[model samples]
Target: MDLGCNRSGKPKLTATIRRADSIKKGCPFMLKGRFDRVGNFWKLQVVNETHNHEPFVFKEGHAYLRRMFDEEVDMVARLHMGGLKTQRIVSLLCKWFPGACVIDKDIYNLIEKLKKEIIVGDTPMQVHVFEFDLL
Candidate 1:
């Protein structure tokens, strides 16, 4: 796992080290909290990792997933020439995906990713937007 520094200045590795027992009991695959030292006392932050709490790789994974979904959404949007109802579009995708799961959060993430890319208006946006629109 990537044990990089977090926004609160506590590195992920330190959290893992401190809360290894709790995580082992709960979900070893999760990095859900942090360890803080205030003078001579140490405190364990048992907060679950929210979307914003996620580290670099988590964000990258979401970005990659968002790109994939955006491509699909863009294709559908162009096919119908407008925005689509949430359920109708999801139903269409589900037909092809079968057991695959696409939730509201996934759609929101994709939209956010697309908007950010559009706002950036960089070379990546040019390539990805064209590809998405075409497909």
Candidate 2:
């Protein structure tokens, strides 16, 4: 509902609100949201995951998402361990697993789900924003 703008031309994002529509009611996937503050100091909560189960790690004839000769999970773990930025992670992935198409969004989504934390870093810089240290 017109979430307004954040000084810049970019529209400020808000929590996903489903309008009263038959399509939303008929949809099987459940919606969830989380709030995160970016380096630009703007806060927004977006709908992250819908389905209860994980998407297919592999499809009928080929790798579905990452399609890497090496598994993505391992690479993700390595990136986390190395504390690399999204671009660095992608570069490392390219070096190790060439021909793999690893999107930063996908990497963020995977990191969010598996690590239960937000990938907080700037575009040209890197930093460990936060970690969900649950005791």
Candidate 3:
């Protein structure tokens, strides 16, 4: 979760970055125990009577929530280099990275990351190539 803020709270943006996360911090998860009668669910207990932090409001920006594992990233690179479209890649990623909240935007971000690793700095050249290919 390089949220544009370094540990010292400074920006180190190398490229144009757009962030849409509204994640917060200092939230604790707690709940009260309610009886479940469907399947004799007596194995649950509540240790705290009150939840101190807001879960819903601060649960968005955790890096683990949307992070791609090393293996997952490798698969993404393989799938992309094999000429698979982004949409298809995303669909397959869901199957491969089950329980992961991966979206098309994440796929595109990963693709761009892979591109950055290969091509040093040719963003403008990419745009020019796109235009040339369209002709």
Candidate 4:
């Protein structure tokens, strides 16, 4: 998973690491929390504090594991075209998919790829020229 940033610009920390079957490292630490009405604040209770496997101390990935669904790409294009910044796009994506994390570089890369598809490549240029000729 890619590193995530919070409102204070600090890297968000998590114990849960999703890994493939070949490199599975399991950590059995869980924190279940709820709001306490009496204190009017949140309270956290640790369900299990045993470490079966190593937890990730530093997050490192090129977002290769994140599979961008077709609808997500479409949303990226639409939001980018609507003048939303990449950070906002990432935030929106996280909000839209609660269990998912999005990295801005991926959005940037996707935008560049989409631009290439629509801009002056041989096929794209030929189609644009053909349309112009028709006009």
The clash numbers for all candidates, in the given order, read: 0, 0, 0, 0
- Give the Å shift of residue 88 in candidate 1: 2.1
The per-model lDDT (C-alpha) reads: 0.49, 0.51, 0.62, 0.66
| Model 3 TM | 0.49
Error of 2 at 68 (Å): 5.6
- Tens-digit lDDT track of model 4 for 38-121: 989977777766655454443424254455888889999899877789999999988897655568888989987876676655
In candidate 4, stretches whose alpha carbon ends up further than 4 angstroms from where it belongs are 1-62, 122-135
Best by lDDT: 4
List model 3 lDDT by residue over 1-135, tens digit each: 111211122234445467543433322333445556898664445443344344444322555577888888999888877778888888897877776667677888998777667666668888568445433
Instruction: Show model 1 residue runs off by greater than 4 Å.
Output: 1-81, 121-135
**Per-prediction TM-score:** 0.34, 0.37, 0.49, 0.46
- Across residues 5-112, which tens digit of lDDT does each residue of candidate 1 receive? 234332345445356321112222224333454555544443444333433554433323334444576744453335666566566666765544565556556556
Error of 3 at 9 (Å): 15
Q: Once model 3 is optimally superposed onto the true structure by TM-score, how far is the C-alpha of residue 63 displaced, in angstroms? A: 4.3
